[model samples]
Target: MMEATTQAEVTAYWNARAPAFDGVASHVAQGGVWRDVLAAAFGAGGPRDVVDLGSGTGACALIAASLGHRVRGYDGSEGMLAVARAAAEAAGLSVSFDAAVIDQAAIEPASADIVTLRNVLWTLEQPMVALAQAHAALRPGGMVLVSDGLWSVAPQFRSTYDPALAARLPWHGGLTEADARRMLAETGFGDARSWQHLFASPPYPGDVPMFVLSARKA
Candidate 1:
């Protein structure tokens, strides 16, 4: 579990990285194939409400907004939210970006059609709690889309975080698709599915294999 003191350190770590976060290719919103993948995960049925947890720089939130979905993005770092808000404004997209930790966001119960967490689960000290929050925030059949990979495969990626802070995070090394599905299911989700084709080629440097897992609330 993430104690209050550790949580503060985690937020500070992300806040420090916010300034250059979007400089990375995967952190920014690139349309085309990325857009297609997101659209498919969101599923078709008109614009739906989306809640993006740990939505750094609003990449996923902006993309979701561009796809015409109502979106609210939350993160523990105010610096990240600032960046996300600026990006949303510059892109002419309307998205609510607020400061809220993943496991503790005050999302209304059964209020969203979809919940997303991209490359975020691995950083959490309490990922299961975050998943439970996502499940609670969704309508009965809402979907939760989680994206992450074996980031530890690259020493450079692991070196980005403070050693002490990294030691506190449960999945600082990263997580697998099977880990994601099991976590979702344990949190009361069902009909889990995953896609890795979109990222057949690494989106960024390193040989990290990324994946997107979508599961429905039972």
Candidate 2:
């Protein structure tokens, strides 16, 4: 298990990356396949109450809102929240953003139709705890989308050329598709399944596939 203080570093790292993270949102918006995939998992209907955890720069939350879902984006980093808020305003989308950690977000039980956690698990110090919170925040039939990939499992490109680079990198082990499914099942989720799509921005290697682990509250 990771120590609690590690969260501080995580928050700081994200704060620094907050501005650049909007490129991810832009990429997702511009990409047809990814948008279609998200719509299928999240439903095409509008006005669903969606809660997005670790919502950096409103990537998922803002997009959901744009599609007419009632979205709330919660993040621990104030820097990210600020950017998200501005983006929401600029887009004329009514996305509510709050500064809160995933595990401890002040969401009510059975209050949301959907929950999203994109690329957040690997950085978490208490992933199980955060998943439990997600389970609690959802309505009985609500679905949660866990979007992640084998980022750390990919070759250390920088380290391949420099011997000392590997030690400096933050190597939090990533989950396999099976690992993601098992986790949702173990955390009281039902009907867990998987979907995948490639994102265009940040330019991950073609071999490193991005996956979406969709599960419903039982």
Candidate 3:
């Protein structure tokens, strides 16, 4: 139960964090493995049209592009997009980056072969709206790969969090695997399936399970 954040506030927050966020890759030891996981999740033999919403520093976009998929990344933070652009240019990868609010982010109707949202859903004010937009952007039978986890719901996590601080933070808490499946189904997606893994990142406790929720446009 955190206070609602305005679009401007969200944008500003991420913009200020752009520099540190750009350095995120250094923390991950298995970039190649993660990329392969993503590739397989989206299906192989790609040269597919992919749109990554809330793409941030373009982790998903850059990796997918490397695998020969056409990619377009959208983020609310211009700072993040700037970092993503520089990385793409340095890597000699062709990725189109745009700045747009999460709820307003869009792509051509039935044009995308896949849509990805990684480490992004929990920050959204209206996760369902983003899902609906993803559903609309994808072609019939297109797949969506959503990665998220229950960060704040863990007992160990709760022990460390100050009650007052937790109550005020903008985090949307966690969305469990079952909750993800239900959300996708309700958003006009079908064949919803999910699995969990032990994933860790900076400033967070280890052994927390991250969930990947996959489904296709019906």
TM-score of each: 0.94, 0.84, 0.84
Better of 1 and 3 by lDDT: 1
> Could you give me the TM-score of model 3 versus the true structure?
0.84
Candidate 3 local Cα displacement, residue 152, angstroms: 1.1
RMSD per prediction, one decimal?
Answer: 1.6, 4.2, 4.2
The lDDT for every candidate, in the order shown, is: 0.84, 0.75, 0.75
Q: How close to the true structure is residue 169 of candidate 1, measured as C-alpha lDDT? A: 89
Pairs that clash in candidate 3: none
What local lDDT score does residue 204 receive in model 1, on the 0 to 100 scale? 48
- As for model 3, its CA RMSD to the true structure in angstroms is 4.2
Q: Alpha-carbon error at 93 in model 2, in Å?
A: 0.3
Off by over 4 Å in 1: 29-31
Query: Tens digit of lDDT per residue, candidate 2, span 1-218?
Result: 33545666678777987787756443444545556667878865658999999998777887788778999889989998999899889989998898988877889889999999987876676678778988999999899999776765565521121223223323245567787787888899997776674343433443555578789997
